[model samples]
Target chain A: MSIPLTLVLGGARSGKSRYAEGLVTAGPAPWVYVATAQAFDDEMVARIARHRADRADGWQTVEAPLDLAGALDAAPAGATVLVDCLTLWLTNLMLGEHGITAAIEALEAALDRRAAPVVLVANEVGLGIVPDNALARAFRDEAGRLNQRLAARAGRVLFLAAGLPLTLK
Target chain B: MSIPLTLVLGGARSGKSRYAEGLVTAGPAPWVYVATAQAFDDEMVARIARHRADRADGWQTVEAPLDLAGALDAAPAGATVLVDCLTLWLTNLMLGEHGITAAIEALEAALDRRAAPVVLVANEVGLGIVPDNALARAFRDEAGRLNQRLAARAGRVLFLAAGLPLTLK
Candidate 1:
């Protein structure tokens, strides 16, 4: 049987991570928490540490800022995977100059191989004023494109605002 | 009868303006286009021009770059009003050092006086990575608060992504 994919998309502080975590912890314990964040500074370090401390017991954390597909593939059999975010992963790919299209394909293939349901979280970055820098603009466009692509294939899609869920699909 | 207010919230290029226009035109002719954009540079001018050129006939355009409340109050009795966006109006307010709280309250009061239906468009600016500057951060926060506030009272609220609407209320 095929596994289901749920994409939770929202803005900063919109409770996307918490919401996705709820979905993960809802089913069973020993959930796989795939962390895409890479802490380079104090702010990011604190954010990462906070997320780690906030999660309840029975979560197996996997740090995969760049190797998300590999991380997903390495998950234990029949484990529900919750990728807390793809935006940071995409940021890492872009900053590290990785081939994004190929990485996306690999991630998709890994998702296809999963035996358990998976939920992916991403940010909706294209709804505001255009960013000043060219790189930010390109990133926003790519992020929006990636979101639309995944949303099309996901079994369920949600747009979150102020901690409320609006089912998009 | 009390007027109905619909708030269309979306990211940049998320088809917010187009979708809100559809709602306005669905009612009757001679609709009011309450524009809140100020053309200070080539980009701004170009954007305003493009939006102006994109609209269909029967739109009575009103330049309300700063006085959106006044514009709304004067939107011809029984005319269905479409405010292309509030983010820009907020920008103008902040730039002019206007009292944002009072402005918002006045705008809400103006909305209450409408004898016909009204549709408001706004950008969802809080979803992406936090901005670098304090001013931008404050703006984002205010925009979000404004959206949440209006959305609470709005008869209908929509969040747009990839040009698709997800009902939030």
Candidate 2:
């Protein structure tokens, strides 16, 4: 079967990450954890450690704070690749002045070429009050657009909250 | 004068989080950091820790992975408050059988009651490929609708990438 891509999305602390981990653990083939976070300080270092401790011993971890497509290229075929989160990755790209259109194309191309199942993690940001500042409001708009693009490509979608998972794909 | 509500948005690692923190640090009152992340494992713990270390001293931190409205309500009026991100929060609400309409209403109401300048962080997810799954497609659609609604009401909008901020509101 062609690789299936699942998108896991939720608010912070809504159990999206946990749910995504479970899905990979239960699925077939070699499991790989593709982490998008960079350790900028002590708090992040500890957070990364905790995540490492939580994963199964067999799971291989790949730290790709910005170059996701390149990271995916390095993953073996027939493996199960779980991207810890896409939001952080996107943030990295956006801040670098990388073309959003090109970055997205690279990700999709990699996904299409990969033979393993891909699960992407993301956050949903539009269900809140309108922001009053220009910068904040613009970000909300862009995030909404990006989420739409990723979700459209995902084969399955799940929303998590309170450690609960709901299938939306 | 009413307290201004700011929406901060960017792709992952775009320095939006740090930027948000800077905005709050510049505020006149003691700032509050409303965290929405949950530690299900070591990785998340490290992520949270990194965020904590990034903050300056004397900032009150509140961990509310869910129940954002309640957290907002609990914050003292006239105190500068920062919601680390909204995408996760929305996913939290949506995963628990919460309809988009209700969630938006609740957020709007809570925002109306706030007396301090509130800075909200969110990730941009719409600038990518169309998902193949129904659930992800639905999320994308809903997020878009929600962002549009919020943007209509927000006083300011900004897009950040590579730590650079662009005004759009």
Encode model 2's per-residue lDDT on A1-169: one tens digit a residue. 2558888877777878878988888987588899998888999899889878877767889999888899899998878999988877877777777777788789888998987788898876544444445556556556656665676677777767688866655
Off by over 4 Å in 2: B1-169
Summarize candidate 2's per-residue lDDT along B1-169 as a digit string, tens digits: 2558777776655567877888888878678889887777775687789889988897999987777788889998878889877766666656666766876788788888987788888776665456666666676567667666666666776665434455668
Q: What is the DockQ (computed on Cα atoms) for candidate 1?
A: 0.26
Residues B26-141 of candidate 1: C-alpha lDDT, one tens digit per residue:
99876999999999987678779988998999999999988888999887888999997899999999999999999999999999888789999999888667788889999999
DockQ for all models, in order?
0.26, 0.02
The candidate that achieves the highest DockQ relative to the unseen native structure: 1
Clash pairs for candidate 1: A11-B127, A126-B12, A127-B11, A127-B12
Q: Tell me candidate 1's interface RMSD.
A: 3.0
lDDT of 1 at A118: 94
Cα deviation at B141, candidate 2, in Å, is 24
